[model samples]
Target: YSHHLKQGGAYKCSASNIRWEVTRETHIEYKTTLWEDHLTHQQRNSWIIAGLLWEITANSEDITAIHLPHFIDYQALNDLDPPLIQIANFKDGSVSLEPASKVHPTRVVFENPKFSLLGVIICLLPCIRPIPVKGLVMVYHSQEAADVTLHVYIIPDDPAMQEAIKLKEKGSRHIMKPPVVRSMYFGHDYLLKSPCKQVEIKPKQGVEFCYVRSGQTINFYEVYSKNVNENITLWLHAMNSETCLWEAEVRPGDLSSHGDQTEADSQYDLINREHRRNLIKHINVMQPICSNLLDYNIITDEEKEAILSHPTASEKKR
Candidate 1:
């Protein structure tokens, strides 16, 4: 899997220039007669698009169209056998495959009176050569007595898989500073090596870097620290190649304790939740607030999309 999913978006707004963002939802077992004959092959391609869903919301009902970005590359799409692509718009618990009016290397343009959850579903042959994918490396750590343990995961950059890793790491500190994306093959041999002296990595001699989404047989590397309080770096690269694909530095000292939050912070969060409705009802202006939220890094782009989804000022405030 050596493919990457890049997406961009547009919504109906009066501002000549505005910020936009894209987020993904889980994949659904979509059924349609469009590709009835190739059902099995399509199923094999489902994991590639499981988190490919893109959600877009706008304020204007009379807006002309929405351009949704999908996972499949236009170049790779050209290589697709017949290159069949359809927009799966999900709403009210039912999903319909809508033919996009326009398709480009980067975007699939479409128009809808109202649309909710949407993702691109591409039909391709199962026997085709492997495509590159955007893969993620997650590093988790725990220290007990004089020993430190590190668990590293290299898996698909899917929403569902990442969420499962979150649950899997509960009470364990995620020691990675930031996420590092790498291009990988589904079953190819990728290497994870560390230069730390005397560190013991399990199954090291003839291990293959194997991974299934998250729920299945998850293949990870468990490393025992050579010395207590020692920092380490894990290197990921293709086997037989020295080129570094991705690297993560685990520094235990940089992270705060689990209970580091002060009482004032907790009280502020409580008040914010209690008066959320009051603020939503009373706010007369929303555009500035939305922009401020973006500027202050207080809300994610997904949250901004949700806030703008509401048509009215009070509704958007909510």
Candidate 2:
């Protein structure tokens, strides 16, 4: 789940800083071979110094064919479990081991002509299931008394399985939102913010409003307007859409014949005015709530205090 490099004075890039320049102090050679029995006759015969260098240098675009004929032990190689050898020009270099399933031919390459200790192991194919393997790199110095250093690196195959292991450490199903009916009324606009996770609204007879949550639903009947003669219930459904105002309907009550044309026009104007006020209020209330809830906490302290100070039905009754 986590990765860390081992720390020690041995692994340190510089110990006392005598400025150990690898190029000036050391003459180096590197080579790798599979166990003699594992290599075919063709592989043994065709394996010229040029061919070995070509394979090692192919992945490194900066390395050219001019640098060749590096010394390698031909007769000493034998068939072993980890089947390869590598030769390098520096005392310090990196080694990479890629699984056979994830790589073709299972090879290593130096990417740069000015070779430091960096090696890249190309994994040609994705690893499947899991496999175990070992790798080793030996760093030799020119001075006989200088200690030979070895750096080892390994990569396990199952990344997907590693992710599954990480998931086990953290418990499942934490609640993101708490249950509540968050509503605010501003001017003629009524804004409702809920942590119900889902919401549904339906228009019934009369100018009644229904608010539903997880375990209960509250209905508001004639809550806003008292004049029921020309009642027009505007139901806004928020279930199918994000903006409730976009999905709204108006149900009109029957008009009396005795009503004057001027009176009817006035009533219609009043309704229109109420609707427009409601729209503005909706924007104001939802703007703050949505901005604070969905975006960063943008609601100001002054606005929050104003909401808290405002009297409710229970306060009025008291």
Candidate 3:
């Protein structure tokens, strides 16, 4: 069976006779591009998938040009050279990155000698665009979660990346948390808090959808409380509008009742978040970000000036 993303345009796997729904367990359950498992020191923090992985089955047609939906935006005809764009050919053992072309702002195209698994990977600055994409809010607490600590992640709704997170969170013992998938905007503030007085969340602050502006980076916000037994309702708050966007309940001894709780919100939360996150850092102009933040009205003037006072663009962005 041919696999497709929600857009139904970025085909995950395309083959002549084979079309199947592959899950995290298919091929490699613990691996999704699984870069970290095979990456070298030099390759570390050097690349991220353009969006999602494309897996092809056998009985496959001969390969030619494959249209991949990239995460980057090129205003001109193209911007090549530095921050190279390449086709990530997933082979039996190693994944190879071969040079490719940016045919459009949203599309990256490449060719393959024979089909295996395919995806787009870009190097260096100006990778992720500011545009919104589908996002998933995943929460978890290990069966033996020490001190009743909770781990919440706001991530893109990409299956591979989600599987990778599942792999990393093996310690959770597969305890299910109702995941909410919806549009999430970068630069906007998202806060997950517990309404119970006994439940205390740290940093006491909200996080930017793309806190680091890198798609490769993952946000794991920790929530904690001492040994208590009441079911705690955790609200995913869109702080800019002071509204509760989504919520889920976590019971101390039981997690089964909420397994069927996944749901989607309406079109707009002022702005929506992306499936993958921001990694684009190349910017000739950085002053507008301050204004952007001010327009959101989320920060105080003091906070704005402090962010602006930083010497470098990167600092200001952080």
Candidate maximizing TM-score: 1
lDDT of 2 by residue, 92-156 (tens): 33333322211113222222244322222212134221121221111111111112111111112
* C-alpha RMSD values across all candidates: 9.1, 33.5, 20.3
Candidate number that wins on TM-score, 2 or 3: 3
Candidate scoring better on TM-score of 1 and 2: 1
Name the TM-score of candidate 1.
0.60
Question: Tens-digit lDDT track for model 3 on 1-318?
Answer: 322222111122321111222222222111123444445666546664456555555322323345666544343224455336677777777877777643555566664334677666666455554344445777777556666777787775555566667776765633456665444655677787877888877657887764232236666777777755778778887775657667777776644322232222223322342311121233334457754654565433334444444456656567
Which is superior by lDDT, 2 or 3?
Answer: 3
Write the number of the candidate with greater lDDT, choosing between 1 and 2.
1
N/CA/C clash count, model 3: 17
Off by over 4 Å in 3: 1-50, 53-117, 120-129, 210-217, 253-318
C-alpha lDDT (0 to 100) for residue 87 of candidate 2: 30
Could you tell me how far off, in angstroms, the CA of residue 45 lies in candidate 2 after the best superposition?
Answer: 39
